[model samples]
Target: MRAEAQAYADKINAALALLRRFIDWDKALRRLDELNARVEDPTLWDKPREAQE
Candidate 1:
């Protein structure tokens, strides 16, 4: 039972490591902040292409 629990824990840790590599939290947060700032801008709607992104 202990061995099985350890194996599951190892698998979960490995999956978490893979996800950390796949997702850049810092960059994503920066982009979200930029988008939030853009949302407050009056000119955001002026550029249809930029607003749609």
Candidate 2:
């Protein structure tokens, strides 16, 4: 029972961290867009091969 409760607490902590990261998705997206536009003519490393995978 103790182990199960600990696991649940850990899971809740992880979820809270993720929720904080995405709480302001709109602001984050806007910042990303601003950075994208300021990039050079060729553009930032267009191929995010690692991200794609």
Candidate 3:
């Protein structure tokens, strides 16, 4: 039935949306980790301009 197909499509769209959100969250976390590592470096303070970024 068309209705059944529409329901499936809706579910697929929702799953894809959630997947995109999860991917975005994962990327943000990775970026934060990279920044944290940079902060932990003693030389980071040496480059104050770059560290401010």
- Please report, in order, the local distance difference test score of every candidate based on alpha carbons: 0.93, 0.75, 0.90
Q: How far is candidate 2 from the true structure (C-alpha RMSD, Å)?
A: 9.1
Q: How many residue pairs clash in each candidate?
A: 0, 0, 0
- Best-to-worst order by TM-score is 3, 1, 2
lDDT of 1 by residue, 1-53 (tens): 99999999999999988987999968988999999999999999898997999
In model 2, the worst 10-residue window by lDDT is 44-53
Off by over 4 Å in 1: 1-21
lDDT of 3 by residue, 1-53 (tens): 99999999999999988988768877878999999899889899898898899
Using lDDT as the measure, the top candidate is 1
| Number of the candidate with higher lDDT, 1 or 3 | 1
lDDT tens digits, residue span 1-53, model 2: 99999999999999978987878877877988976665643634576663333
What stretches of model 2 exceed 4 Å from their correct place? 25-53
